[model samples]
Target: MSHLPTLNTDTIWAILNEEIDDKIVNQLVWHYLGYRYNESKQIWDTSAVAEEWREKYPEPPDFIANRPPTVQLTRSIPKENKQLLKEYLGFKGYKIGEFGPRQTRRATMANWLLSYLKEKQMLA
Candidate 1:
């Protein structure tokens, strides 16, 4: 049997409240708004759509953009993806409550929760 890593509340909380790297998030948001990476030029090619989105939200929200991050676990996300994650992990808990308003620690625990379970099992 393979050794399994310890699971703890802090680890879960860390994953749930994890904030994505700024550079990655920035790239994702820019790409979502129709910006492309110019490989040869080593730059991001911007478009009118990107400009408009930037103008509208100078700092785009992590959850609303939905780039597969921790914020999706929270109720703040209007997308159904959060529900799907919970269903996949069989998480049955309060849909919404007072998480103290930071938004990061309030999201669902499905992001890395599945990995922890998978590590402890051998699907056959």
Candidate 2:
């Protein structure tokens, strides 16, 4: 299983200062603040820290904002298999054109639609 990269206070600070844009500082700050009774003193005042940062800098867009929504399957599948899967998705009426210009690939579009369908429990 893939693990989420650990974001330290320093790293978060750097992100807030525009040193990096890999993660959304606001979301991370909210998540940290939501953790009630965190034993770590460093992460204790996440809300205040986040507020200060927000006051100084405009909120940055989420990293996945431009990407099509999809389940990121890590397992390596053959290109031919993926193409077949895309064809199947197309046959199911999940058109790639609906998601906009960037989402032209069948693999990405199909996976995104499938992921949405699965989330709604529409697929068995």
What lDDT score belongs to each candidate, Candidate 1 first? 0.40, 0.35
Instruction: Please write out the lDDT profile of model 1 over residues 13-94, one tens digit for every residue.
Output: 4334444433443344334345565678875455534444545444444543344434422433344344533555444543
Which candidate achieves the best lDDT against the true structure? 1
Best TM-score goes to which candidate?
1
Deviating ranges (above 4 Å) for candidate 1: 1-20, 37-44, 48-79, 89-124
**Candidate 1 colliding pairs:** 73-107, 73-108, 74-107
Score residue 68 of candidate 1 by CA lDDT: 45
Q: Give the Cα error of residue 74 in candidate 1, in Å.
A: 9.3
lDDT of each residue in 21-87, candidate 2, tens digit only: 3343334423432322245553333343345334532332232333311222212233444443335
**How do all models score by TM-score?**
0.30, 0.21
Model 2 ranges with Cα > 4 A deviation? 1-77, 90-109, 112-124
